[model samples]
Target: MVAPLSAWPWEHLGIFKYILYGPLAAKAWYSWMYEDNILKDLWCIHILLICTLRGLIHQLWSSYNNMFFLTRNRWIKQQGVDFKQIDDEWDWDNFIILQAMLASMASLIFPSLNTLPLWNLKGFIASLLLHVTISEPLYYWAHRFFHKPYLFNHYHSLHHSSPVPHPFTAGHATPLEHLVLCTVIGIPITGSILMGYGSTAMIYGHVLVFDFFRCLGHSNAEVVPHEVFNKLPLLRYFIYTPTYHSLHHTEMETNFCLFMPLFDALGSTLNTKSLELHKKITSNSGKNGRVPDFVFLAHVVDIMSAMHTPFALRSFASTPFCMRMFLLPFWPLTFIIMLVMWGWSKTFLFSFYNLRGRLHQTWVVPRFGFQYFLPFATKGINKHIEEAILRADRLGVKVISLAALNKNEALNGGGTLFVNKHPELKVRVVHGNTLTAAVILNEFSKDVKEVFLTGATSKLGRATALYLCRKRVRVLMLTSSTERFQKILKETPVDCQNYLVQVTKYQAAQNCKTWIVGKWITPWEQSWAPSGTHFHQFVVPPILPIRRDCTYGDLAAMRLPPDVEGLGSCEYTMERGVVHACHAGGVVHQLEGWSHHEVGAIDVDRIDLVWEAALKHGLKPVSSVNN
Candidate 1:
């Protein structure tokens, strides 16, 4: 029963579907726009806006989340999860050829059949089937050629590396191979459309089906229902089965069918050997199917604790050989913490590892009874800290404990080097070998104003205050415990003036929220906390350099302070809590867009965080900045 090409059923069905739905969608769009009362229109717009905004926010959030997971070493193939048997995967290049052929065909047919005055429904469907048939044989032969020695390594071998199919590995292919495969898909449909028989709907459906089938074959999920296949026995002759595709991924050669199962049988490639190979690969699935949350959490905790410690702060001073071992675990954890912290703070938080002073395996041995005492001492120290914070807050004084800042100063003939680079800016470098009450007072009391301290320490906090009596700055120390504060302050430094104020660590933790409260600071305003007092800000400036096309307006969006009037000095060094050094005159006056002058070759060294010593005491980036 040869039907006329002018009246194919599927083509008529498609036209009907478009005709039926198109007006309904159009009417809905217009009714919301013009026929609406103000309230109705506003409500509809609000709903659409909320949906769109939520999607955008979610997309950004996922990017950060993925980064954190990647950094935390969490993405490593866990023992129980992420099973890859290196045998059951198909080369993605095969799929690329398949998609290219389909895409190419789509490109051709849509323009020709839809536009021509002599367009017929039957011609559109025939053209589509012809595209499908032609691409299959074409891909089969091209795929076989990829196995040849001269071509395989540079061209086809990359896809064969992944023996197991995973969603993430779907698009992995050589660029040249992808182009060749895609061209086959594109040419026929384009040729069809040029012959004045274009149909956009048919092309879209063709691409959609091809992509859907490709994804289905590689998904590694057991989703296809057997009942559907059973009811239609004839389907077995045409559609490629999961088992069929799985076998292709396992074998180095054969099974070149693209859309249909008929080619493998006709080409004499389908056999018991390929089936056995795929089955053998699939048999390696051991019991575990899911990754435990606690494992991930434990790794994260280990990394965060290691990074937050003073040892990681001194990586640069450590030997490269030793530093790598110390830093390996921390890198992933630090990455995850940065991601989590970025979301929590809505600000950038960069984590650097200190490889110097990292504990070696030998340190764990029971030498000088130190290894046995280490945990006891750490627990005892933490307990004492907890007591100090609790005691002080109960009475009324603030307590702050300062730790040693020296990256490397040998203890017991072994010195810990500073592994990470120390910031060149105004970092308060303490000279004391060990932090004690007397050491802190001697070093910082002369200029000390408002002290923002965390943790619990009565001896250190009170002694420093007594020493700072000459300088009248408010003391605001925060800790989780209050009882510990009382015990420490009981032995207060003599002549300590301006009584120490007590605040909860809870309040301190939440301080960032209220810190920006009160009236917004105008350009004319002066510091409200105190003059000449050092404040610790948890803020980190943008680490990645901005695009040269970035202007003062972009800086403002990042919440950076504005430039001084004419000189264009961007004197604002971003900090977490406090605003400090700002750029002075001419700092911001770089040839305005000197960055865009070289479109492709960016001068990476030209970027600088411009801070002014005399003015706003903050820093901003300059395009062609001089350090």
Candidate 2:
């Protein structure tokens, strides 16, 4: 059965139009009463005031609707919307203001344009028709020209920066491009005036209508009901909708019509995606699926960090030159190596249905054998992580978390090489190490005056050791090198060194009441720990086996509120009985809907915030660790 077609609410339309045009109409009426010849002074202060008011009102309306209305409306789903893109739109508002000022100056310079009479019904109809006929084809061609490679990169690309468009976005173009657009739009009105078939009222009315429809086209919210098109199918060819213009922004090569769909149909440039989306948005079937609030990319170390293996050696057989030179001989070996690695590494979707009723997904890219200890191998591993990140991005992941060794490789700049190399991905990358450090420190008891710390030279280890020293806790720093330990002491505060004891031997750490393992050490080295000491393991792919005597803890996990639907079982060993601080940090940001890099040297305050969020989510310490 066909649904009954309904007419668009006249009152709603009237209210919307009047909000924009009321101020312009009042100014025009006041000017008409004072001036005997309105068109004689085209640069009149009243007209300039009206243009400024129109621009200001248009901006205000767009902001209010996009922020308050369109974002919440299910029909205008916010899945593809990028906040960075919205920020760019706000930046473009300055260009729009400049365009308005230039428009007023153009009026002052051109006295010949002031030829239109104040009131003439025949002139009004002729001017309106001429504008529709002339501007449509000109705008279509000008838009297509701007899409050419050079122009697009320089000018028109700003307009197409966002996948989702809002009303104010209509004016979000480069100044030169805006001028070109204005000139094209003015052609028909100027022609009508030269032919003596234009009126001042008609010119102003046409501009009001043009601005109104342009805003509507970029609103991203469909205001026109589908039933109207269903009832009168021919009207679809006559008018262009917001969905139609969105395709031009998305697909970037089609639908170049200004205010009419006639040119688009005739030129065969109409996009079918727009029509399909319009139908889907207006029907019941489109409303069922859920859109993820946040997405993340995570990379885990494939091989143990101690191995210090070069990635080129690990992937030597797969290199292009090796494959070409050896052909069949290398092919079989490469296949075997790839099969083994594929079994070792994997990408898993970590879906979180949290306490606040938010659904988020994190793409965990576990690197099986990409680990390397040398500086040169860091780039190879980064490249491997980059490929995984790009793959996640293709699946619509919005952010990425560099976990464990991934964070170590990306420290200082937070995967900047990947970001700089792949600007097209637009995914936010963060090192989850900050919160991981916080969770580890939180495990230390207040009564413990002395602590044994390993991996003292590592970034996280250094940061944690410094923090512990600052709190007046006696720290016995254990590392493999005496030179590195001396360097660390020299970098530490004068008073901090007094409380810190540097040692190259595991036996020196035996007297310490608390043990924190920050680096990978052999299980045989674990024999030096005192019988009753608390053991905290921070290293991923944990080095020490779980013991019966000591309280062993890793990172904390974000506990799901039992009632949420579609909850998945915990996967990571660190998250099996307890969550890792790094994993918890990613989950916290995902639940709160923030995208940022948390890499490099982490501060104590950020750690506190993440730990607090973990506590709020019901995360608790897992007493047992995997061997």
Candidate 3:
């Protein structure tokens, strides 16, 4: 049996966790719907609003801190928050629920708490005074109490687990520790009520201010301007910076004050370097960050996929991509955000990791997948892609890879448009299709003598066909254009020419058990495939599993080497630490220190060479998906 102090009972609630707050929400709704005195019963509504605002504040901080390009140099902690930290802080909102429940019960026990004036100057003064004199000192000593060897081992260690804190990390604590915190928060609040000075505005203001400070302290980004302390030197003891709070987590024994360093000073436990480090970090904030050696230029697929961004929802991005009902409520908000980004945003650094001591970052073009099909959006999309390329080149990036539709041949001629426009550019522009082809071709077993191919005329298609023909495997090239098909057939040696045959319709592939799809196939088109056929796809927004009897493969992807470091988010629809082959291709280029631009048509001869280079550098192909 688990010890009583080891875990919280409600910790296993998972998605049903929201049910705890349903009573308060339902009360607010019922009062608005049926009660004549809705205003009199609004204390519950106020509580709900405050809870929502607290959640909003935490989310905003999480989003802003993850925008590394803006806060890279200003972050207090240099290390990134990995998947473990993300998981640990996932339930940070638990404290909010407990606090709400306690406040509701208090209102019932004390009739005066049910209805109150909106504002009172005396109440505000009372709250401020009680917070400074009672809450602060009580919290300081209570915090130190939990730090005792026995208490910390069983309780306080949970909060300390996230050494590189995010906004949510502020509320990550054991239930026992939170009870002490509830007391610490409730003392000031309850004291004001006893003195008849409690008012709605005072309550809201106190909690909002409390939440603001807590989120700021754990945001990891150094946002407090150093000039404030410089202008008022004595104020250093009154306020705590993110850097100050960070020291508490790292050093453990010092900087125990809550929001103010005054208590820490009184206790003689303040970190000595807090002020100095805050000043140094703030002084040079936004001036510089580590330059990436490689960049993977990608774009959003759709509104749903947009929320899967690392900065959008940390919990969502930490796992494999799947549409969940929870994301439905966010659609309207995400739609508005999409409109804003369409006109305002540019290529942005999404996430980064290190491999063999070299830095690699994923930069998004801010355009959605559907928008790529819009004729009018073509120029704008290309403009963003070009800007990212030039920016990488200016930053001395060694290799910039284009992912998915970002390298559409018609829009930028497989990245040749940028390469030719900037002839003097030193950064290598890579479409990475060579490795994409190799990944697809290698999926087949040697016994498979023939395979049906769709999108037979596309860049990846042509390379796959020629490579397979070279292996003497008969390839049923599906296409309407005899001219394009003959051109690819001509590229193969005369003896192997017969292996590459042109067929105009999907019906031709009915007999083939191995189908390589380079183009999207509708359910009707997919019906042509015989049962038990395995579909290997390089298609974007991979085809649906319309035929249940047939196995389907996810888009071609490769797993990062075991030694890869600091990877915290998944690539779109790809599993964590696994990326599209094009992405891995550029990684290999950077590791090999190659100088040529991998643009336009792929070199069939280089497919094997690139594949070998990727394995040599420890990048392994993700095992084929069968579903």
Question: What overall lDDT, based on C-alpha atoms, would model 2 receive against the true structure?
Answer: 0.60
| Every candidate's lDDT | 0.34, 0.60, 0.87
Stretches > 4 Å off in candidate 2: 1-293, 299-357, 369-380, 388-398, 410-416, 419-427, 482-493, 546-549, 555-565, 574-578, 590-596, 616-627
How do the candidates rank by lDDT, highest first?
3, 2, 1
Q: Write the residue-wise lDDT of candidate 2 on 382-408 in tens digits.
A: 656777677657646555666666656
Instruction: Tell me the deviation in Å of residue 371 in model 3.
Output: 2.6
The true-versus-predicted C-alpha distance at residue 281 of model 3, in Å, is 1.4
**Top candidate when judged by TM-score against the true structure:** 3
Which regions of candidate 3 deviate over 4 angstroms? 1-3, 26-41, 624-627
- Where does the lowest 10-residue lDDT sum fall in candidate 2? 314-323
For candidate 3, lDDT tens digit of each residue in 133-170? 99999999989988999888888898999868789998
Q: Each prediction's TM-score against the native?
A: 0.35, 0.44, 0.95
What lDDT is obtained when candidate 1 is compared to the true structure?
A: 0.34
Q: After superposition, how far is residue 46 of candidate 1 from its true place, in Å?
A: 30
